[model samples]
Target: MQLPVETTDSINKISELRNTNLQNILKKEIDKNALWKGLVAKNLMAIGIVDLTDMSNIKYAGINDNLMMYAASLPKIAVLLASMDAIENGELEDTKEIRKDMRLMISKSNNAATTRMIDRVGYEKIEAVLRAPKHKLYDEETGGGLWVGKRYGGGGDTNREPLKNLSHAATTMQVCSFYYQLVMGNLISDERSKEMLEIMKDPALHHKFVNTLDKIAPRAKIYRKSGSWRNYHSDSALVWGPNRRYIIVALIDNDFGEKIIRDLVVPLERVMKKARNLEKETKI
Candidate 1:
């Protein structure tokens, strides 16, 4: 249970330029929207967004990011990363069957496929990938993000996540960090991270965030994972926009969770475009 001597230094040590600017802009946008305000009044929602186009001028923010919520199928992103890690460590084989299963698990959100992978790679290894010092997508300080406590199927307890004890738990900040690491080629290794991100690219499931984002930005490439179970609907993605690149994650626990995710896309895209325009103006 001990981390490396310095493991807890800080999980998101990429760039620490305070979230004030991003928060202010996002708050203004969210507050001005009537539907968004009504949705916020009803249920739990967590959001994390960052503009990756300019890492040097990294702008990022989150709302209720620390409240760990059931991430549904989203934590499968952890499984994808763990599979790559195991292959690199020789703990798990990189066979066609394994790769296919991973693809199904991710792209299709196939629970059976996910269980096969969870059994093969072992949940411990997946969590290891999250808690790894180099990655630490889920760590003690962050209250343990991206967790899979029980089997996806053939389940019994189906209880909750480990560190925080919420079934299939995730934090928006952690999910975004995972994507950030993948984009920056820091999840495992540059080569392995790219391979994993490629798997996440062009997700097969087409609802919620995918549906909304695709409608708004037809040309953009989205590497995403989403989960909709009862009242929990979650979506997170690394969006390669035509003129901007950023990461956005939403975890909503509400009756309107799906619609809420759908409604937020264009607005977030506009924020990215605005940031880009300002960047261009400064250059000019």
Candidate 2:
């Protein structure tokens, strides 16, 4: 999403402090609580959050934020962006079939649909977009952000992300950026990014973050993608609330990652709400 000139300037004001108020609150809860302590001990958890109320006044908070983990289905969002990019560039058709595939691939976590979309988008092309100077959603310096090197449900070993050599991979910082940029209209053209986000709306499979967030903010609107395989689970979303809009990305690499991700919802909900109230709350 294309952020306004001043909004872009605000994104530059990001602060990185582990002991900031929001960080302190979240770290205290995740560290002291049994629900999240085990994952932290295993070095299997990472998270990033961006307050998007003013775009320019946004602040970021994170823990293990740069750690890369097997992203599960979260990386499918990369393909979603790439597909829209192709459509915008006139390299692909914007057909009903393509739209359905994109929607299902995200909303339902459809592996087959993701494979089709990825094949059309091409792994190299997706990388190019992520690594592009403009987006930098995935950066070598940060050990990479979002990547899909293989088709979902296995196969295409030749395409796994180079940083971790995993079929799918992500970093908390990057996924947060993905949603942040998507919200800023920087992932693709403003119009195409809106269409892409619309495809992710009203998610059909609600199990991870969305499920837990629902427990607190029952009516919150979320556009998210989630994935779980073996012990790893990852979820990233742009969440909408009565007072603000924000992005939260969590990457976990343990058997209990989903539970840990879910457990974070309450504490995060509190911190996020308080943080936004500190700013001038802007309802999306």
Candidate 3:
């Protein structure tokens, strides 16, 4: 899907600050580690990274733009935005129940809770919200996997396409761009953005990524979400620093456990910290 005109403009503005150093940084990372070999050994498909701090500086380490993988729980971020939009427009109230379910959907990756929240906001509303001024959603429609309704424990086939097929997935690039808009308060109200960040702060729900991050950079505040399927695994995070924010996305469709974590997570954290420090020093 084409990015909206306003979004294009914003992207152009951010792209002007493209950090060329990040390219060499990531290239050296991939070359230095044998984890890419392990990822291939496990039949991994594709991995893509986007630097949200500077949209124009995006780095794709694996396959090119054609690579598409199942979004899994990453789409929940879009759902969360839609729900918040509804609440802000007075179409839906931010009741205790709504807040509770939103928290569950985001923090816990609770499919049932997500479906319930989607039901409240309605699918059409979600679609419309994404097509709004500065947000966009791009993907294909395909068959066979976990239907949203059934996957969420609801009792209907809904005749909808299954959520799995690689053909019906999104690029890591698009997902990261969508998230950047949300983080910068361009997709929703500031109040809503703050609310969403608070939900992301829930350590219990974000344990998978946060736990690893805590070990390496305990003092850093990182907000992340992960998705997994039979052979695919992905994690996207916004690392908050004293002077800058960094976006890190790691995707592996392999079973190389410790290797994926060490090569991707550990080194990515180091890169992010170095980027953060450099930005602070340069006052960018």
Candidate 4:
């Protein structure tokens, strides 16, 4: 599937703004403390930062464009958009069943619920929606030659190659781009975007990401979604502050600690808080 292409003008502008500030932030971190080392030991990872106030202002640090890791639940944002688009188009009824599973798939990250939602939304429709202009959903399997096997009764593993799995895998850059597109009202209507944001606001589903942030910046309101598979884990979300909103996505593919919330999650959350504070002080 041909995913949506970002606008050249927007891309150029965002690239310039992000690149200009990215180095400064990195330098400050290196001078103050060596936080990057902790991130480095956790296998390969990527971080994409965007100013939610203005999509054109964006920054990417650490393997920004590299298609290195699996998307895992990160793609759920696309599924969420597809569901909202279906509802808006009157193609799928927002019946009780649809509503229930939509909540489960997105809010709770329920694998079975997500699978059923995928069946209802139809793979083709989801593809088309993502392939639209300025969208960011890409066909990972075709590019990497990876095969993702179906989940066995929700938890069992299937004999499959990591690259082919469509159920849960995506590049870090692609995932961040998707959120950017949504915030810009490029992929779906504004009303639909707001609806999706509401679903993301559910605290129950944001445990992994929120738990981390709560410890550091408890006052911030976070709308986020996270996914994990074996050694791979990802968290993507929009962080809201009194005067700013930022989009943060972090992916780690290594055995760090017992729980993702403790090891990778808290660290990422602290980094985000640090970034947010820097942005505020610098007024970038």
Candidate 5:
């Protein structure tokens, strides 16, 4: 099924969705946990959330959203977008293997499949797509967003991001913008966004955000992608349900980052719920 559009001319980009009350509620929720607050103080964890319950009046809240960190497989999303762009432009051949690999690369976070897809599209192509003005998924001027400068596996030259030299890196802000633009059907095209979302739907690995979400919102349709390597853990998802239409992105660097992300769901949900009530109060 096609995703719904959530943009007005005045608020086309995700950057335009910032809401002060939502930001305050989000901060209050995060600070309630001493350990989480400590991590925020240390710049080891970053979270970005968007309340899409009312698509016409989106609300955004974030903490250290632009603090770029090594994001491991999360940047594979850059490869995914580049591949889609190539296929659309007829710069790369669309094949059955490519389609299967795309699903595996995203749904299972398959390194071998990701590496092959990267080789098919090339790092230069991915870089161009990100740096392109239309997408700007990675921009040095904006603290450097999603980046894939090296192959997922081994045996290739490393083209690290210029700002941080991270082989693969991302910031919660950029990731949040990604899902925002994606669902808005502005990623390549509406049809392409749907295809990408199809690949991301119902992720295979159930951990971090998905692990908790599966229990709390069993019927929610979750389009997600996540990554983990050593102490670096990251998760991003556009969750669509009755009253839970929102986007959540977290990037953390700590031994307990995985658990931290899983634990963040309920509190963030509370923030969204309260934001909704605050909107209602203003209307009444």
Candidate 6:
């Protein structure tokens, strides 16, 4: 099934959806979970969730959503966006090799493919695009959002974001904004968003969020990107379901970050489900 088409007001209304009800619901869930609550207290874990079941009245909430952290390969997504921007602007050639590498880079999280794309686009291009007025994806004022300072493969360092100075860094809210914009067809353009979504569909690696999602919602269409490096683990997904739709993004720094990410799926889903139910009751 295809994603919902963008409406005339999507771009304007797509800013951040901060609803009090949803905020309380999400915060309560996290507080009840011992592991999540503790990590959140230490500012080691950040989660951003958006309930898209009612696009007209979208709801969003997060805990430590603006806390930037080392996100490993998750920020390859910034490279993907920059590539699309370059392609659309005619700054980069649209060749078969580029297309193939884009797919491998995102789907498989292949370091070699990612580094090649980064080389082609360059850190300057990525930085400009991220800080562009329309996107503000890596705004320093907002705690520095999605940023790709270093290449995926072994490299010295390109341009680490000024705020956190992490090579590959992301804040939950910023990553969430990326997915939200993509789904809204505001990333570059509608057609470009579709192309990027195609590349992200059916992630190659099946750990973290995808690991548990594979079993629980087998039929749902999931477009996701995830990463893991030593103690840092991160995952983000745009889950499109028959009855439920939402975006979930997370960044973690801990020895058990992998398990923390995997375990996050259920509670996060519950938050979405509970929010949906509450929305129904209000309507009734």
- The lDDT for every candidate, in the order shown, is 0.76, 0.76, 0.56, 0.58, 0.89, 0.87
lDDT of 4 by residue, 1-284 (tens): 11112333334322333454454454344334244445444445555566554334455443433354665766767677777889899988988888878777777887788777766776667667765555535544323211123441355433332444445555655666666655554556655666676677645653555666676666666777787777777777777755446666666665541244334444443454566576779975
**Compared with the true structure, what per-residue lDDT tens digits does model 2 show for residues 56-118?**
356678888878888888888988988888888998899999999999899998999989988
Tens-digit lDDT track for model 6 on 38-88? 999999999999888877777888889889999999999999999999999
lDDT tens digits by residue: candidate 1, 1-284: 11101112233553353366567677677778776666655538888888877755667777776668887888888778888888998988789999999999899999999988888877667766777778767776766678876678875545355666765788888888788777666777777877887788889888888898777777878888888889989999888865657889999888788988988888776766665676578799
Q: Specify the highest-TM-score model's number.
A: 5
TM-score of each: 0.88, 0.87, 0.73, 0.72, 0.97, 0.96
Which prediction has the highest lDDT against the true structure? 5
RMSD of each: 5.7, 4.1, 6.4, 6.4, 1.5, 1.5
Q: How high is the lDDT of residue 181 in model 5?
A: 83
Clashing residue pairs, backbone N/CA/C < 3 A, model 2: 1-184, 1-185, 1-186, 2-184, 2-185, 10-56, 149-159
Choose 5 or 6, whichever is better by lDDT. 5
Which window of 10 residues has the lowest lDDT sum in candidate 3?
Answer: 141-150
State residue 31's C-alpha deviation in candidate 1, in Å: 1.8
Q: Which scores better on lDDT, 1 or 5? A: 5
- Please list all clashing residue pairs in model 3, or write none if there are none: none
Residue pairs clashing, model 6: none
